[model samples]
Target chain A: MSDGRDVRACLGVCDDAADDPQHRCHPQHVGLRRVGARPGGDRTRGRAGRLLQASGRVVGGVSVSIDQRLVELGIELPTTPAPAGAYVPAVVSGNLVFTAGQLPFVGGVLPATGKVGEGDGLVDPAEAKAFAATAALNALAAIEAELGSLDRVTRVVKVNGFVASDPSFVGQPGVINGASEFLHDVFGEIGVHARAAVGVAVLPLDSPVEVELVVEFE
Target chain B: MSDGRDVRACLGVCDDAADDPQHRCHPQHVGLRRVGARPGGDRTRGRAGRLLQASGRVVGGVSVSIDQRLVELGIELPTTPAPAGAYVPAVVSGNLVFTAGQLPFVGGVLPATGKVGEGDGLVDPAEAKAFAATAALNALAAIEAELGSLDRVTRVVKVNGFVASDPSFVGQPGVINGASEFLHDVFGEIGVHARAAVGVAVLPLDSPVEVELVVEFE
Candidate 1:
């Protein structure tokens, strides 16, 4: 799965799919590529491998074009969240794009607020995890706004997640896993990334979670 | 000051200074390079340029080698603080180095604690500002530990600072400026970078300030 040649070839095909509209690799159209065309017949992961009909990574056979992957996962990216302060949503430096810390703002509103913990009057860790995932989606929205498409991303470099937690809570990593796991689901292998999660006293707008990303792009 | 040629030439000479100890851009030495060598004698800042004995950037003649600059500013970078968890202090990807969030620890101790705000039992804003600077210094120490020498840094890219706030604390930028200004003091023009400042509910170890850095190196 880490083979650079295979990854490059798959990405090259995805790029071609993007460039030529005639190619019907659009989202809502199944895995990135039809597994029927040239199935390598890889049997590494038992019957699951047989289900892979994605892209050029014949090894797993389940690498979909980024757009279609989102549709397949039933995740529609919301509008890129507006910045809350005097800064852009994301900044590009060299080959990397750094996203500003984003709160979980769904439909321009925080779904929940308050510190996260197990006690009463606090947001549940489970709910905060969902918010972390939503924040991650917002980060992708920011990246997509900057790059025009998420397909240009080559690697998800790092994720920094801040969870507003009660003094007795210390499950920051578990909470941030929502963001990390969502990235993995969308980008497949390339979405896997290094991460740091920490508990914070509070976040802007009283949101329970905030996430920022460092991604390498073409 | 933003001239590529001058910045490159200055950095190259700084590299040489690091390579050859006899060249002596050591902290004890006056200025990175004596303005006496080849003063372009630019009249931009008038007599202030008369003090321009540092490196090849004749524009302001004020750019000092990072080491000597710290010395001149009466600042000594403390030992690189140990990361409290299961991660490296800094990671290098391509030309960039991303440092883990750093807390303001001096001599292995948090000088003060508690959320920052304008009330009793809270960390004072001024003290929190210094803590941010100390945290920024720790970030530099971590960068130096990874790069072997700070002389190799070509640019300071992004900084993310987190301040533990007392709910009413709205001076995050002011507190984070301590880190930003310290970076400018050390790296001169290169230290000025894009930044994000946020007030968090709390931080690990109940630290008042935490700073992370993304820097570019040769």
Candidate 2:
């Protein structure tokens, strides 16, 4: 279900569908395209390949302390999100994880930054969408480091997005749509979540957008 | 320690300290200042006086649903924060309160909006610090709604900030100082918290800044 061409084509179709509020793709399709995990897919039971086919490469670059028990569950940590300002990176209280805002940074440079409807300023929409998705990936990486595996994630409860936009921009939802859809694509039904799409006057580093995620532990 | 003039002077000093990178008052202070309550001195706990001070008229033109538990504990709820964009006001989960980005909207219109560190966008150091403090008040209001009382707040936890800024600006820590110091003043040691401050290219409605609070419930 996740051929490269198939994912790209699905992205294209979803972009079009996003423009029409009435057109909502089922949550399963998004799960395949984003995180690459199929709903009800199980790993650690020697079905690792199936889980991999359903998601992207979560190889390395992650550094943080996660629970020892979670590590034993076959969860691979992703890279920690870099701080973009004077604030700390993440905070933990009990079983919940609250991450600071994350930008879509590749090699410490914003490939795209700008309003989605106004054309990417520092980064464009497609790229920003990718960046937002990547930011979500980074968030997962952080979660993995803290909890030991993406498996401990009960659900992606809420996502708050801040998109840098032009004054006249009205497609805030569309821009954040990329991230939202990607989340579902990754976590499947567990990935489905409640969210807020906000158009801000600007974002940190003039990046097109910034994202923050809240996840529950199993 | 609660000398009227001394407390006022200390507030003045902290208010101007926004750009100082040192100490800035936070929510507890804002709450205390509202009631002329200061440490090591007047322990004014009169019911009528407390209500008059905490819930003065109405704010932001939005009513919040204060938790009955908080009410039983004698905590007053602040007004709901006005949405900066096309998003719901706030969300609650279990014993936590997550407030959407709150702006410095007083009556209805923003008293100030623009980039900081550029010819005083919202009030150089003192005013900007006060603005952040005011925003904290709004966040407290949101928290009260979820937990019913400020006392239910086991800890202030974390605050994430986004400041609209001029391209050449770099005064994030200074601006966030206001909120931090204010919270400390209001909740005493419980108000002390972790925070993040980032300079954004812009914010919704061209508002100078946006703030969100993560509070733990008792």
Candidate 3:
């Protein structure tokens, strides 16, 4: 079944699906068959699908898959971080999922601290950008926790990045690019979204950067 | 048609359907009728709805009307403000609408500038709160521009309030209350939403506060 290989290839599952009975007839493969059987049925044509295809990693005329791209990029989604406060991490209303402001925490601890652009003694802008990416990953984890799959997302609508900066520092946008670039790397064009990068006085837990998202999902 | 009245009341629209033929039937009214006709149909019963009803303006066991409440409070929505940059004021995706960050520009100019809590000689926190309310109003105007009517909104899912704060300020939540309270006053329970109050170092045009919204609509 060449189509089955295409499915496995797209999802970055096991290449030995044909050899392994368990992988050969997975439910997602069954669903893919149903989707592919229909005429003019391009699974990657929708907003979210279009985004995944933007990576230009197509195989056998099929669009590149998010899972496969992640694997190729050597990226792994981190565990959903626990909330540090009384609030839930994300809320879904209608078809939209809103993530709370997320800090850059790994294994339940902050990787870095202090304001961005404080120069001699504080967090560097480059390091702060990485923190923004980590915070964004936490946001994506929150969305996955709420929706069960990142595949359900149609578009990354907005990204609001807050940077704690020294009064003289004005590179908030450059720091926030960490999150925006990471999103684009994963979702491609559909990941391109409106954004606001603002310099903040301070952040919760004294984080150098915080990121939040508004996503539209099917 | 008490059911119609219930829907109208819940949406805060006018009751003079006959006097104003155009007001007699809106598409949202029809949708609400379908929702209200369902068993245990509480149109304003979710998280956002619960907050709108907290105002306790019930009539005939239905929530008091948003339109009437605005009249009672002498609040009128301001005109939609032009964007200060290249971005559109709002974008509609499926059943969701996302508004760009809005400044407190009344009649095309900011009433106040500088950081919140910069007191001694700058803007007061209290005045900054009012500015937040005005910024929220601008966001609502953007929503109206996209949907043609505020009644189309089913829930205010999220509100992101950014305060340009002095290093010493810690009352970010209290200051953002201006936008939250104003939304509650206008949309009632439907206006209640998950919110993030952030302290930023500066805002576009050096405005004191900026507000953005994510709304779900019929």
Candidate 2 lDDT by residue in tens digits, B1-218: 11122222233323333344323233122223321111222335453433322332122354422343234334344477666668755577776677888876665577677667657334464456567766776787766666666666665667877677765454565666567655644554344444556667667777776778888765
Q: For residues B94-155, could you state the per-residue lDDT of candidate 1 as single tens digits?
A: 99999999999888898888899889999997678778878988999999988998888887
lDDT of 1 at B115: 94
Best by lDDT: 1
DockQ of 1: 0.09
lDDT of 1 at B107: 85
Per candidate, native contacts kept equal 0.15, 0.10, 0.20
Query: Per-residue CA lDDT of candidate 3, range A128-205, in tens?
Result: 877887888788887877788777777788999988888788878767877865665566545656789888797655
- True-vs-predicted CA distance for residue A164, candidate 1, Å: 1.7
Which candidate, 1 or 3, has the higher DockQ? 3
How accurate locally is residue A36 in candidate 2, as Cα lDDT from 0 to 100?
Answer: 17
Winner of 1 and 2 under lDDT:
1
Sort every candidate by lDDT, greatest first: 1, 3, 2
What local lDDT score does residue B200 receive in model 2, on the 0 to 100 scale? Answer: 71
CA lDDT of every candidate: 0.66, 0.54, 0.65
TM-score of 1: 0.56
